[model samples]
Target: MKNLNVKNFRDIKGYVNHEGLVMKARMIYRGGPLNGLSEKEKKLIEKDLNIKYILDFRDEQEAQLMPDCSFDNIVYERIGALIGSFKHQGFDFGNLLQGKMTEDKLHFLLDYIKDGYKHMAFDNPAYHRLFVLLLKNDGGVYFHCSAGKDRTGVAAFLIMMALDMNEEDAIQEYLLSNEYLKESNDTLCEQLQIPFELRKNVNLYSMFKKSLLI
Candidate 1:
């Protein structure tokens, strides 16, 4: 699962559940978009990982703009877990890039993300379908959003909980994305010319801190 050319890609195997049982390796994976996967990478994912289902949490516009690389025998589904007007739920990175991230805007964005997490956790059809797919499919299920950190993170948390993983363990798993995506995030900060002091807040926009879970 490591060095697979996909951002934030990792096998959910080896994590201990509440029963103190480790999850089977290669049975589930999570990551970012699969748009630019190479042939070799696709073969690795198909033949090695055995991913049978790909559940995308991105909205229609996001998927259309950068569709996933299709694999034979894999079922693909797009379920926008946000469940609202895309524009309203979406974060405006352009504003951040333009140095418009004031304290008020930062607070607003944090509240928005926290609200989004709540929505995904409760009464969200996308997560409902996700559980259905998990039950129906014995093979691997690879689920992701644009960055695999918000909607995708919540989905991962739910799945771990269903497997009887503890609250703290599930939160730890969700926070791993910040580590996995560090390189990409740093590159993004460089591109946006974010000051060292502002980079932490900017990263918070897409990251899942333990505080957010609480």
Candidate 2:
């Protein structure tokens, strides 16, 4: 698991639930898109992680643009977790690239993200299927979206809560993506030439901690 090139990759093992029961290791992993994994990295994911299922939360357009690398014995399922919501509204990253992400637009984007989280938590059929998949399969299940910070993070929060982990613990786990993706996010902001003021207001690559209130 160490030295894997996949961004935000981590296991949910060893997390203690509210009852003080430890989560089993290697059974559940979360990370960013798997489209650009190296041969060595693929080997590690396939052999070391023994991942049998990949629950992709990316929309169809996102998947089409950058499809995941195929692996032996892995069943991949794509669920557009935000299909009807902000997926169509399209928060323009071009604004960020041009240093034009105003505070008003940033707040609007945060609202959209928060709404998306609520939809995923309450109304999305994808999560129901996810729980069913987890209940039936005992093998490693790897789930992710583009950055693995928003949709995938919410999924992780739901999963932890479903396992009887406390809400605070689940929220903390959701926020861990910010820490894990800091290097990549910093590099991205630098490359995109995002303004220091905008970066100060929000992380373009992260989920808001307040979004978990849902």
Candidate 3:
């Protein structure tokens, strides 16, 4: 992944690197690996940013789907969604496949993400400590979920804001996941036997991208 200290995200060349690390699909975008990151990339980022801690926002199923990224001596934590007792509600195999959740229900779930952030910002003091510990103490920290676009996107936005990066740039950074994620989305759609039109419905980049940060 390029450092992305530039603009014009619509054109991949607008980004520095020209390894064809760009995609026509405009939803999920990024520059990394799903199976395993290139050591060269990892080393470059680590050396550049002094990364030390890794926060993976994925659940067990996600870990099973894509092999976890393991660094030799770095601290890794899974601060996944605060689903709490309802954590299993969406992963009961047949349940999530149905996509039976109503729009209101989905909105409520999204609200859960928002509420969690509220707690971190105001209610939970420990959240601040942990966040600072990660950003300042850790050489490099990478937070990711199943798609690394939803939960991870939120964390990335927070970090970007903390780093004093502008809000628009933060949004672009979050959108980078769209590039690397569309192919994965296509693969998942095929596995679930999703039809064409229905697959489009599941792609929520347009409808939900603006909401992930909040």
Candidate 4:
């Protein structure tokens, strides 16, 4: 079998990702502080997958944390996350979702759902622009963020809905955030010197599910 090699695939400096229906789309990466993947596997993707682009859902900090990606023919587009800083409390989504403020304090985040979450179909110009790209004859597109919950989940939900996926399917997709955040769990667990139980909040799937009216 022709093994996928990241080093070889990185020749073009494009982000390599899973190509065919060989597996489910996931949050796993080939390399990171946690369970890192091999460059060979990444090469397999570049050699076989038809990925057209990668829609990064991460904030600036998330990008800085991990920044070594290269692919052959794929494009990487960073769509600044919906999260803004919570300070000033004006319209800063970062601070609001930074473990304080309305998210847990006043809990008024839902008030902006139509603009920030549920109604994201067109509310976020960046997301919509990518959606349009996906709608075209693009090979495949993968969207992701830090935990793949909240902001990323909302984007997933809206995209699925637009794709005509049934509500059940859309809901299930959002729930995938739980598994996606495992990486964060490992890091937070050791960083906070706490058990995995306390780090359960790392699972972001439910956060998105809870925000929906359906």
lDDT of each: 0.76, 0.76, 0.48, 0.48
Worst 10 residues of 1 by lDDT: 204-213
Runs off by more than 4 Å, candidate 2: 91-99, 204-209
* Runs in model 4 lying further than 4 Å from the true structure: 1-37, 83-122, 180-206
List model 4 lDDT by residue over 39-151, tens digit each.
66555554555556666655556667765366767677777656333111233344444452222433355444433554444456557756776667546665555444555
Worst 10 residues of 2 by lDDT: 204-213
Clashes (backbone N, CA, C under 3 Å), per candidate, total 0, 0, 15, 21
Estimate, for each residue in 1-214, the C-alpha lDDT of model 2 and write its tens digit: 4668777889988888878999998888898889888899888888888788898888777888779999987889998777345566653354434655677777766677666555567777777777877887678998888888777877888899889988777877877887888887788778876677778656522445545453
Error of 3 at 74 (Å): 1.6
Off by over 4 Å in 1: 84-87, 91-97, 202-214
lDDT of 3 by residue, 22-127 (tens): 3222222222223465776445434554546555555666566766556666566655453432253442333545554455645554554444444333332323
Pairwise TM-score winner, candidates 3 and 4: 4
